[model samples]
Target chain A: MWKSKAKFLFLLPAVVWVLIFTIFPLIYSLRMSFYNVRIGQGDVFVGLNNFARVFTNEQARSAAFITLKIVVIAVAVELVLGLALAILFNRAMPARGLLRTILTMPLFATPIAIGYLFFTIFYEEGGLINGLIPWKVPWLSDPGLAAISISLVDIWQWTPFCFLVFLAALQGLSEELYEAARIEASSGWQVFRHITLPLIQPTIVIVLLLRLAEALKLFDIPFSLTGGGPGTATQVYSLFTYRTGLRFFDLGFASALSYIMLIVVMIIVSLFFRHLRQIYD
Target chain B: MSRKRKRTKGIIILVLAVAAALWAFMPFYWAISTSLRSPLETFTIAGLGIPFIQFRPTLANWIDQLSIGETQRALLNSTIVAVFSAVIALILGIPAAYALARFRFFAIKNKDITVWFLSQRVLPPVVTVIPFFLMMRSASLLDTRTALVLANVTFILPFVVVIMRQTFADLPVELEESALVDGATHFGILRNISLPLAAPAIAATALIILAFTWNEFLFALTLGSRQAVTIPVHMAGAVDTRGVQFWFMAVRALVAMLPPTLLALFAQRYIVRGLTLGALKG
Candidate 1:
């Protein structure tokens, strides 16, 4: 009995913190979603009206779609390129550790800084690409082009993440098993297709799940690059919620928007987790 | 028999690796080069970055940004929030991690507790940010560093619990068990036995948390206004305040970029394990 009580001490702070910060805020946000909340005015209870608007609001719906689109395109491209690079560098090399570290630098870089730097690089009048090209492109202005630009920058920053993880997973491959497989394999493609792919499939799934989680929250780059601009073309869901609440001060509707996004993200994540557990467990 | 083929493959890989490194390195290089250039030089020659080779570099932008009062205040706020939040989270989270890693609770299953803790990690900042924003405003704590610190703790705490739990779980338990038999309390075992063994991981975890909290933008943007602006938030607003001074914006970018980059360099060896939550030990 005393031992159990002693153990509870260890959990006290975390429990209290969750109760105060995470749990309470969740409860507050849920309550706020059901009310007509505007600052400098009293809250008026409006049952499910805000949630109904979330479905009705076209920008809100589109922001959700755009976010999912960018995440899929970016993560898929990153996985392929990163795996290629990882395979390329898996052999014996001098200064490989230094080289690996240098390649992974962007994983830790500030997204806002990366965003602005790319903004200049993509600038039409005197941008880096424009200096090399025969034509000036509307990188941030065109709606379709703007989303692609954001995705490209994301790819540049995150490919190294996939590369590093896949490299680690590849390095962890059982040397004896690989050597035995090599003896029987006829071609490199055959080895990768049969032996290597199956072994790294678990890593690939884990990487995809990890990347998807971070990518879903997409906020900083679009906030910096387009400011959700050229008219909401690149605005991710988080930024949409941001503009709605902070910029426009639509507190009630924004709360509903955020909650709607939260549910959507949770569903996506739970589905991924079921698949993830099938591999990991 | 395949020696010649192997040699050719090595050379091709070497060339591709160098090219990829250059491509990966271009932005950091550009950040430095662009910062050193004058505004006219920046806009006029975007493709050229080789200081004396491309254009004569200048320190005027860096010096100007460093001299600003808002820049100094924002940097200070960022440091205070990141350091305080990370420290507070560690104090609260480390013991909890130990409990989860070692002992199972009879009431709530350890797995369920861990899931509840780590679930905060994937929770969207906006969902919580709305309530945090309103509550902070009502509590008269909005735009203050304290509010920012609390918001940062909400995110950083989950990372602490998850990562440190892995570290503690991986530590050899025999020593801890022996210490307990020697009349050592769980707290004593944690402090004297587990902590020293996990020092490297603790430092790595702290540095990672600091880097993440430093780079956090959304909470800082929403909860912090005039008094509590972080480097990233301020850097985001640099173009508007200075009206697209590309050189100055470059300077601000470097300031915001340097801390996390330096932390990554210092903790690079442990970062993969830390980042993947000990899923991959790179």
Candidate 2:
């Protein structure tokens, strides 16, 4: 009995902290979503008005669309590139460790700093890419290119993460399967498609889901690089929320937008957890 | 395969490896080089092509950025909040992690608690940002480092608990059981056996948490106005206050990247595991 009491004491602080800060605020924001909360004014209950506005609000809709677009393109690209890199590194290679360490540098660099660095590199005038090429492409100023540029930044930073995950998964594959496949005269691509891909399918799913969760919440890159501009072209959902709640002082609407985002992410994460359990079991 | 085919594959892999390295390192290299370049060179067309060869290097931008009171204060604030919050998180989380890993006493099972913890970690920061902002404002704690620290703890604590729980779970129970057999209390066993055994993981967790807190932007941006601004928050401000001093921004970017980059290098082995919250076992 005493030991059980002591164990509870050990767990108490973290539980209390999470309840007060995480749970309480989550409930507070969920309630805030149903109200009309302008800055310097008390919130007024509005009965799903803010949630209703999300569907009709053009900026919110576009922001959601742009965020989904980034998640799909960026994650797809990272999946391909990361898988390729992992396959390459899985082989016996000279200086493999050194190359991996170097490749992962961007993964650890501050995102806001990365945003600023890329902002300069993607600058219209005297940018590095423009200097390398004959033509001047508007990397940030042009709307179509701006979205691609932000996704490229996301790809550059997160590809290493996917790479490492896949590499670890690759290394964990059963050697017996590969030996049997080789003895059966299976070609490299055939072996990968039939054997390797199936083995790492769960990992691939987890990485994709994780990347989707992250890319949806991406704020610093777009926030710093383009400030969601040339004209809200790069404004993802998080930035839109920031502008709506803090910049526009429409806390109620921002709360609704965030709740919507939360729902989407919760769906993704629960899927990831389900997949994780299937793999573990 | 033929020797020639094998050689060709090796060369291709080498080339690809080098290309990947350059792709990852080039921007940081450019940023550092640009920071060292004279202002005249930074603005000029000819000086932008390749770094170091085209311009005379200078320390002016670095000196300028460091001399600014706001940047210095921001750096100090970032360090204080990151270290203190991570420490606090470790204190609050380590025991909880050990308990979840070793004990099964309460109505709440370990798996249920873990899921709850992860759900908290997975919730988008934007969801909490508004409520936190309102709460901080009401408490007159807005723009204070304490507020940032508190908000950071809310996120980082969950992560610490998750990672450390995995770490403690992986540790052999024999040592703790033996200690308990010798009449050691639960706290005694944890302090003398588990913690020392788990020290490496604890350090790795701390470093990763520090990196996360150091690079965190939204909470810092929303909660901190001026006095408690972090490096990322300051970098965002540099982007917005727009005479567009590219070199100054470069200098700040380089400075901002240093701590996390160095810490990441130190904790490289555990980074992937840390990132996935031990989901992908090696």
Candidate 3:
């Protein structure tokens, strides 16, 4: 038998790395959140004031609202579209491999690059959609449309990811398992309805939760697309936090806001994941 | 199934697939077409600016983007940081993954321990970026690739551990247990049997982490701003005084996007197993 002491060695480096980088910083930022941190002037401790401002401030509230809106819309559309595509592709299709490779091209694209790509495409005057049409639509300029545009871009990018994962889940179902189900079923769709859906339900839940977690952290598209402009129209929660801490140098409030973001995400993830854990454990 | 009905179904699938492919291809088409156009010719063409038909495609944007020293430096730095970050993560994480897969710890459940490791990822980078900025600034690592790599390891390590843990768990434990009975050490078994079996997963994980580190922007933008700028940061700075340079931005977007996209395509075969975090594998 190996030394009991040596057993700890394998896990030590990861623990140390997390402590030094992740845990330390999280705690350090927790302290910073209580202070009124600014540029040039020294930090002044103002306990819960930053937290109070996060709740009261119009910008923060609106940013929160907009982020929620985008997350809900984008994730919903991605779910529907992705599931349909995945279900459609579960069959033996011609050139399936090539089609999959092509469809999933946007999955690995830089989000900021998507921001820029869509910027030009949606640029009212000489832009692609406008140039192709007779009307010069204000895609990025209109306040209501900008956030919708952001959701569209997210849908464009992540729908393929959902499709891929769902397809994998569907494809992973063994033929024997399906054959057994098929014996009791009258038609093909009945097999999917009775067997495939139930089997992949866990995967469905996980993918949905994964998409939700990521959607909550939305930053890149809005940051590059509008730069939180047209009067903070598309300024998401992350972008607002970035501007508060980095650009505005109000580190304390940003810290508090980020903490709140962290806590909210943790709560959401745990609530969702508790049910999922039973499937694996 | 009737032959006519099956044939119609195939045709429908083909048409739908082609339509989906076009939607997928639209962005690349726009970016590449934009990159090839001169400023004067950008809006002149009809029907999404078909090159050579409406206007001659120019290499000026590519030449302009590539000739910049910052572009070259950013490319080099991103390569260095991504490669080093991926390697360090694999080194630190694979051992832990193996341990989790094989050993039952004294106190903590392996499940709980695994969850703790995964929780590190759930903490958004923004939550950690501020303190990291302060810390990096104090340590004088603000503009170094080392700092970027370290910060990257914080997030990427969990992926390696969780995915590789699943990979190792999937591997037949019989061979390892038999090897142990034959007087092989646990480390020896991992080295000779577990690692070789898990090599494809390892390679796949490394490539994914590499692509991620390469495409990373937030930390690189904050921590490695000047001297250690990455492709994403460089691509972000593609704008000039005359508003956003669509052509140049297109060129830069293509440059930054091509590597990760190609790397992901190469790794796509493993992605079904690798990325689902073993949820489907069960």
User: Considering every candidate listed, which one attains the maximal lDDT?
Assistant: 2
Candidate 2, B124-187: lDDT as tens digits: 9999999999899989999999998999888889788878888888898987887777889898
Please list the residue runs of candidate 3 whose C-alpha ends up more than 4 Å from where it truly belongs after superposition.
Answer: A1-4, A38-42, A174-196, A275-281, B240-242
Rank the candidate models, highest lDDT first.
2, 3, 1
- Tens digit of per-residue lDDT, candidate 1, span A149-216: 88899999999989988998899898998788888865889889988999999788878877887788
lDDT of 2 at A188: 92
lDDT of 3 at B232: 83
Selected candidate, larger DockQ, 1 vs 2: 2
Minimal lDDT window, size 10, model 2 chain A = A272-281
Worst 10 residues of 3 chain B by lDDT: B273-282
Model 1: per-residue Cα lDDT at residue A189: 93
Docking class of 3: medium
What is the lDDT of every predicted structure here?
Answer: 0.84, 0.87, 0.84
Choose the strongest candidate by DockQ.
Answer: 2
Q: Model 3 over residues A1-281: C-alpha lDDT tens digits?
A: 23345568888999899999998999999999999876567889999999999999999999999999988999999988888899888888889889989999998888877888789899987888888899878889898888899999999999998899888778778889877877776587888777888998877888888788878989888887877667998899999998889878789999999999998898877855576355334
**Least accurate 10 contiguous residues by lDDT in model 1 chain B:** B272-281
Can you give the TM-score per candidate against the true fold? 0.96, 0.97, 0.94
Q: What would the per-residue lDDT of candidate 2 be over residues A138-179, giving only the tens digit for each residue?
A: 999888889899999999999999999999999999899899
